[model samples]
Target: MPADDSPTGLSQPLYLCVADELGQLIAQGQLAAGERLPSVRELSQRRGLSPTTALAALRALEQRGWVEARPQSGYYVRPKLRRLAEPATSRPPSAARPVTVGSIAARLLAASNEPGIIGFGAAIPEADWYPVATLQRLASQAARRHRLLIGEYSPFFGLPALRHQIARRYAELGIAVDDDEVVITNGCMEAINLALRTVAAPGAVIAVESPTYYGLLQLIEAQGMQALEIPTHARDGLSVEALATALTGPQGAQIRACVVTPAFCNPIGALMPEAAREALVALCRQHRIALIEDDVYGELDFAGQRPLPARYWDRSGNVLLCGSFSKSLAPGARIGWLLAGRHRDAVRMRKFTTSAGTALVYQHALSAYLETQAYPRHLVRLRRLCATNVARYIEAIERYFPAGTRVTRPSGGFVVWVELPRGTDTLALYERALFRRINFAPGPLFSASGRYRNCLRLNAGRQWTPDVDGALQALGRLVEAG
Candidate 1:
């Protein structure tokens, strides 16, 4: 390892400094794969540090996947091909493509829900993350105290109390939406569906992030609208330049709406920088294209401060922002809310035609829950846990996956995008993993044109236990062998 010359008066802890030194050595090829790494005892003795600090440093590297510990054999440099690089920013064909969401997602979704598998497929938080006991208590309270609410159907705009709470949350994100402008839906899916239907019609083109949430593409396909996928980057999301080019081109007039997840987008977990977000909103406004913002994962940022959604940049109210408590709160509550802005009447009518309104029971429950400080407290814990899991998962992937397997470094949310060696078929790997009782989201599912055949998305939403780690390691082995 490089000499740990602790830079003069740094804020980083000693163990972290050690970890950084070791990481540098590995990256610089000073330490070769499969070679035995320094033991905790050696690290302590050589660095002249306490054993605890040395162990912690080694463990940090372990979590980052620099080295792996063998039960009795000590630590060794993990063997990897290191030949592949992270997937480049996507560049989908310019023209619109008719949606053809295959039947593959059905099988994967089914597998994700079924027992007997170590799941890394579904973008759901760990079960423990939800305040189940609290929700149960609230549910009973809501049933007893709000009997009248259940007896009558919810108002077209949804329960005023829930809308107010949803609006307050939006206010925190810098969108000053009135409670009356909010419409409650069964989940984020429904909110997005309503937004798509309101701004677009059959055969119209809807622009989306190239490798976006599969569910979004599924929604567009179900509505019979074509998709024009805009190129997006893994770290910074949705390319405003490409979008501008697409919107001003001859085919721009056909585009009815643009759907985007500016905060921790699914599959890739990319965040759109503030400038890009502003540019996108302005572009949409200039082109008169309606913008639908998915902020479902907005508040789960590890940094705690929420990123401003495109709605914050909207002056004409053309941006409809969608948020759901499903990922952060109880999924069973099925509580999602939308601020439709100018399209309020259209969304209100669609809500009536579809499920009428979000269930009063769920609305009341979530509303009551949000009134307490528990929601924010739960979010803090959930974010910390998810971040740690992501770090540990990255380490595991480094230790076990082949070299050249590029993975996303997400700042928030619990999904990581991994690009494997070229020609490595993730669909085939999916089948092999299912046979081994492991499930992960294959890359092709997220695209309209079936790209990313060598990529896969791993869910870090689950608690990082031995079983989860084992399954991830097995997945790496499978990719390497293939």
Candidate 2:
């Protein structure tokens, strides 16, 4: 076969083109489950391709759930696993309520890095998964080259080079953002906080997805604001129709801002369709409410396409976009960015008052890394690993969890929202799991109104180990005992 012989006639990577052909055979039942696939050399010879390309195709198939690799053996077609039922669309109360989050989330974060603990609590990935050594080397080189700048603070909007890199990334996603419009933030949280401060005030009503990220709830609580919960789907994301209805209700006019994670939202892992995203942007514009998008997980889509942020649909500069490398790259770097659109100045001032400026060394190092065009390559590996891990986690949950448990089938990101049998009281279950060195985020922490008592969220970002499986079994047994 010629190098350009993609069945789809598109200019995709050669490995993906080959993987698609193999995947089609699997889908058509030509490649039966449990059947061993051709060896790398055999495949290469058969396809008139190189061994490296053939191996890459097999790995791609493995990542896509079409095949599996065995130790010391070639790949085999993966058997279809039973799919778990997904959690239903959330139905939070229609009225706006005061944010009253508790210390559970903080406690979880505090214990996240503890040794001997199985971390299913935090969405953080293992450090080894990151290009840590490469970053360290880059940082050292930056320090040597710019030793005098070490004593100086980063610009309030961050290093111009880093801002340019961030803007270039957004441009790749078809979002036209000037580098000057981007603010370097400590992390996505600070970017969001700055957005909230710029748009809403104390006691203001903020529209949020029901069962949103716990950190967002904490942010609202810290600001003494009220949360107007909007029902969100398990898969499709925040209900645009529901949000529109709420916006026109008695509480609608008072809502100062709408915060959404249109791409793989935390816990529930919802990916809003493009139509919904466009509608959301338009609705916020009509209501004159700020659309603050937390797009930290936007680039982690397993489908190989980086999902566009809601900010992509902004026509009048009403969207405030927040993203971070914490999820995709080095979390310890504390690097994130914000595009505040028309609110850029206010956000910059807020960022200045909040943290003065982000660290410059990491920004310089990251900028250098981006210049090498390595970030995209890094994401390809990370996304593939995350997709495999997510599949493993969901399969384990289905096999080990209680009979009535339902989990989210996230197409992106590395977390899943699990709904246990009614009255399971996951908070109680969480405490029990904690005693066994197991940790998972209980459902109530994801909401301000103390909802989802029978729910929990598990982290698929962690490296899978025998200990993890044991912990899952232990958790299942504990639930059964209760």
Q: For each candidate, what TM-score against the reference?
A: 0.85, 0.87
- Rate residue 234 of model 2 by lDDT: 98
Q: Write the residue-wise lDDT of candidate 2 on 1-482 in tens digits.
A: 11112232233477766775676566445788999999999999999999999999999788656688999988999886655689889999999988877588778887776888998998888776677778888898898999766787668789999999999988987889998998999999999999999999999999999889999999999999999989999999999999999989999888999999999999799999999999999999998999999999988998799888888889899999999999998899999998999998888889889999988889988898888766877787678767767766776787678788899989899998889888799888887888899999999998878999999899988866667868888988887777
Give per-residue CA lDDT, model 1, range 1-482, as digits (tens): 11111232123477876775676466546788988878888988998989999989888777866689998877887765343345689988888887776587888889997888898999997665667767777778888997787698778768898889988887876678898998988889999999999999999999999898898988888888889999999889899999999988878999999999999999888999999999998999999999999999988887788788888988999899898888887788888888898999988898899887767877777788888777777777667656666765666677689877898878899998999988899999999999999999999899988888899999988765568878998999999999
Sum up the clashes in candidate 1: 5
Query: Over the full model, what C-alpha lDDT does candidate 2 score relative to the true structure?
Result: 0.86
Q: Clashing pairs in model 1?
A: 65-395, 81-403, 82-403, 82-404, 84-404
TM-score of 1: 0.85
How does each model score on lDDT? 0.83, 0.86
All-Cα superposition RMSD per candidate: 7.6, 6.4
Task: Summing lDDT over every window of 10 consecutive residues in candidate 2, give the lowest-scoring window.
Answer: 1-10
